[model samples]
Target chain A: MNLTAEEKGILQGAQGKGMQLALSTLVRYGEAFAADRMVEIHSAHLAGSFGAFIYRTYYDAIRLMVKEGLKVKVPATLNPRPLEKIKFLDRIMISQQGFLEASLAKLGVTPNYSCVCYDRENIPPQGAMLAWAESSAVQFANSVLGARTNRNSVTIDLCSAVTGKTPRFGYLLDQNRRGQVLVKVKAKKIDFPALGFLLGKKVVNRVPVLEHLECTRDDLKNMGAAMAASGAVALFHIEGVTPEAPTMKDIFDREPDEIITITEEELASLRSFEKSKPEMVVFGCPHLTMSEVKTLGEFYRGKQVKLPTYFCMIPRVRQELGGTDLLRDLEAAGVRVTAQCPLAAWTIRALGRKTILTNSGKLYYYLHKSEYGATEDCLKFSGVSS
Target chain B: MKELQGRGIISGQATGKALVTSQPLNLTSGLSKPWNLFNRLAAVYYDRHHELYKKDLYNRVLVFPQTIGSTFTGMVILETIRRGRAPLAMVVQQADTLLTSGLILAEVWLHKKVPLIEVPDPQLFNLIKTNDLVEVNGDTGAIRIIG
Candidate 1:
């Protein structure tokens, strides 16, 4: 791997112990991927908000960096914290949260503790090189915003942030961003997240270009999350919708290597919550934005839910929706809104044997007891009516 | 003794019973929840969607096509290796970034090196069995399927 003089200096312990270790970590990681040179990134989003208690080595490494007064060289945002404001949260994980939070704070990371970092904090322009983590965010940044990054692991994200550069390889190259598969959506009622789920299962690890589809920005977010969860899909295209693929020729140089058609039946076949009523409903796997919160809040306006329901939103959403009638309605309907990652918060152990009904295919795919439910179905099951 | 050559992603050696599967493992969803603290399920493969559900991943030569799911998978693998609950070493058909990230981090940051071999051949499944004792040498890129 070719390193700049300054990068070489850091590896030779010119920057200090923290940087030396961080750079060495990147160098090894980069060499594995056969990256020729390191590319400076505009920003980074980390997948390191939780897992400190069990990830002792990870936290210990962070503590060392924090002690060294090391700060992220680039603008960095964080993933969700553990679900602290809930009943089923594991107490042990909660107790360990403060240390990680403090460590992240000292690292000079932006306090945007959510997965959808592109929506607000650290939004990258078209073709911006990034070292972001969190699969959903990476997908959105690459496909939706036309930013470039691979599905970087947590440590890689951190090391890149510390050095402000990621090894140039994978999605960083223009040729790699081309769509490998053609996915045509033939579903009558499009469940964007479900379609994403199916797309992931079918085209695992390949970039898929959707031919016939129109979806909102929010739909893509939820769908992208599920795709990353069920499969390792980092970037996907909507042909006419996504930033890069304004036309089919832009993303596809030849006839797609393969083509798959998705129907509503295929999506419905993925739903397992039809028979048994769910005990709880979870709304966010890649936490909801303020706009999504306001939109979903309309369903609970003057009604109560039969089952426990939670809207796992970003902290910024709650802050923006503060003192509003939407928040009041959601609260009155007994909707527990928390700024935590549902994937980290509601584990299979947390909801052992109990069924979870969710609008997020990402959550449904991850949680063993969770089942997929459409927006209306989730509302109907929760005893909410228009 | 049947031996095979592959590429090494991490440098270490470990021998253990093989937990062989053709399916790509989602290490994130596979080992849900946190570590040994609340994670009594310690390194057990609990992804209900997977064929290896309820199988313990601890101290085994985990063989799979690759890994899928959340990027948080890196932390889970690192945590497991830290807690001594990770597979003895990973022998995979394809070594993607997520799998390498964990073991590499464990190696570079924590001084804990777990052997990771990328066979890149689909034929790897034909040679190894579920309970067969296998030795993997990451430094030499050597794999021994021993009975």
Candidate 2:
């Protein structure tokens, strides 16, 4: 497979037992994709934040790596913890949270604890190679930021971080990055997440290039999250919005293999469940940034939520908004703010499994019981922006 | 006897009744329900959104289009294997990184392997069905429908 001497040394156990195992797995994983050589990665984002006691083997594996003094060669960040202040859930299931935190810390993770790892501190340059996990982050980075990374699984994500190498195939190669599907957006209102959900279902696991959709960065982020959830879409491009696809000819090799239109009514159907009022509302499935929080804060300005409303933010981003009046204003309106993963938080059956209303299509796709809603509609049910 | 050839991503051999579904399986969300914790017998497929909802996956040849959802897919899958409650082997329409991660980790580090094969043919679902005895050889990428 044309492994470098150093890689070969690691595979032959010249580095250590843990190092050997990590490299060996990458080689095997790469061979499956027909990757002939390894590419060095600029950074990594891990999705191994869940530390439930049910995952003893995972914990043991992490412990072994830590014991072997295995550390990330490049900068790294983590996904959110499974349980964050939801005391109603079973504690025994996640008894190993602290152990995992310590293990990851020893491995030199940034502890930002958000799926949106590229937000501020760890933004990689365009065309930078990465070995990131978390479907949403991989999609956003590949699509929006034009970074190259395949959807490396959780353990593989960590292994790439430790070794600073990934199999050079899939999205890392230029040929595979070309958009295979042409997605025409006929939606009048362009509900970002819902549009993304529709796009994902239509073009599963294929790169899609969107046409005639004027979108903001936050809109793209939310849309990409949903796309990754409903489908295995790791990368997508909007006509001029994303880094790669500036024009039709720029992103596609030929006329797209498939073309699908997403209309306002189709998006409405995805959010049709908004008719059934949700027991609670959630936002930030990919973890909201400060700008997103401020936008929603204006909706909650001088208003209280009708039902249980929660805003999940990246811990660092939440801290960034700490002293802002928007944070103060939202707190005054009784909107619960926490740095947690809605996908993980809402999935706990102990939370009584109530129907959830979320603006995040990713959450709608994953949460045990969730309904898609527009920003105003979700806020309407929560007695905001009235 | 019915036979098909495909690519084997993980190497092993096992035989079990096929639990076939055309839908993509989100192993992370599917097995995360409290049912797996409560049931000592088998890893219950509890994702209500899936077509194979509330079915038992233990020691069966789990056949699906592919896996979807979070990177946590690997660990959830590994945990099931550790608990002796996973499918004997998996035959997927396309084996992505998430589905193969946990099994590969188990094989490399934990010395426990579950044969995972990828049959890219669309007609694989048409031939296999639930309750049909299936034999899978991960080394040769051979799947036999031995009813």
Candidate 3:
């Protein structure tokens, strides 16, 4: 990998054990993606699920690391979940109390109710390297910030932070970030969530180039959220939308690999709403933002989701709602103001092996194609259980 | 098969189950409580009820792109590890998640250390199986399933 002498020295443990572990992890991650070397990340973002597993595994690590005197130096922020509360509530649930909490104390991670971590912290220099994990963050960083990062997992984000490098792969490579398949939109201004649902359903397990629509950073953020919720698109290439698409010719890292068009009718079929009474209207597969909830609340006033609906917004965002009495209004209207994500709490409760209603394509696809094959629809409705 | 091998990471030599996944996991929403509980309550649920979760039935090898989700997942994994209920070792496609945190903690705090192989090869899938004795080489990003 392209490493400066100082970086090489750090990799060789001249920096310290923490830096050594971090560098080693980065080197390995880069090699896995077939990248030869590392790149420096201007900023870092901490990630955690709002469930029990995080307490069990990572919580313990942070505790031990803190006890050992490890710390993060670069300016870093957190994803939009409340880790402290989960730690406090579940502390007694496990036999080892101080084990995980101490580690978190050491890491100094914040529960800064924000999804746009780089924007929130105002970190990541223009065209800088990054190691963010959240899909929307990845999309925004690569497409908006002109910053470089391969779509990474939670584990490697730290590695990049510690080592100050990431493998040059996926979105980091100029050749890899280009638009592969072309996607056309028929709607005048494609609704953000529906656009994501349509894109995900059409490009299940594959990459495609998006076209025929005007989108802003906000619109793309919404698209990223919906795409992650409805399908498995960790990264997406939008023509004239993402940073890579400054021009049509530049849309493809190579010549246009392929193209696909989307229509309103095709978008409609993706919803799959059932005819019978709906069971639930679930939101926040990628986890809802306060702005989204507030927007929805305006339409949903005095009306229940017309079915049982669960919404899991970011904990920090939930805190904002608490001050505004939004939670009270939401709950009084019969909606659960969930601070934690349901998908993150897969170990807490079962959604049953039954068909569920949701506007999220990512959740629908995951549940529908899950082991039990629970049926799902975009339109509000019910179906016979298997 | 051109094989690569290293010591097991999370569970020690578990045999009889195999599931390989290289898809990256986002912890914030992908893994949750009841699912972790489900993983504990119903072993068979891995296959029929929770395919999104890598099943460890029949044989005992679980491969992932990497461990994702929360740090607390390490504890649940440790609980399963203490009970001998988890897979033999975790072959992570990458090396960044709480998987390493859990392994380090089990080794240090809990005094239970399991091998966690960080192999980054996208092609490691070709050489592993549900019933084969596999070694994970985190150093080289490869896996060798012993016949």
A-chain TM-score per prediction? 0.96, 0.97, 0.77
| Every model's TM-score | 0.94, 0.96, 0.68
Candidate 1 structure quality by residue, lDDT tens digits, A147-252: 9998889877888888898888899999889989998777777888898888888888989999847788999998998898888999999878998888899899
What tens-digit string does per-residue lDDT give for candidate 2 at A1-386? Answer: 78999899999999997788889989988888899899999999998887776777667667878999888999998998766774634466677788899999998988988888888857889999999998889988898889999987878888888888998888999999998989887756788999888887778788888884677888988998888888888999989788898888888889889888877788888875546658888888888888888878888988887888999998987787888888899899989999988777665544567788889898888775678888888888888763
Give model 1's DockQ, 2 decimals: 0.70
Docking class of 2: medium
- lDDT score, residue A41, model 2? 91
Top candidate on DockQ is 1
Query: Model 3, DockQ value?
Result: 0.14
Q: Model 3, which residues run further than 4 Å from truth?
A: A2-16, A49-57, A82-106, A114-126, A162-164, A186-207, A216-219, A226-232, A263-266, A272-279, A301-311, A314-338, A345-347, A351-356, A365-386, B1-147
Query: B119 in model 1: Cα distance from truth in Å?
Result: 2.1
Interface RMSD of 2: 1.8
Which residue pairs overlap in candidate 2's backbone?
none
lDDT of 3 by residue, B28-93 (tens): 334333445545532222323234554432225666665433333344454555545545556765
Cα-based lDDT at residue A218, candidate 2: 85
lDDT of each: 0.84, 0.84, 0.53
Model 3 per-residue lDDT tens digits across residues A1-386: 67778868976878766666666656644543467766666766655433243344345445444655766555455554332344443532333434433344456554453555643453465577777766556656765676776555554565555445667776666665556667777766366666776665455434566764676555676576556544445567666656656566777656655566767766666555534334555666556666667865654455554456566676666767885666776776677677554443332234353345665544554454222111234212311111
Instruction: Flag the better candidate by TM-score, 1 or 2.
Output: 2
| Fnat of candidate 2 | 0.78
Which number leads on TM-score? 2
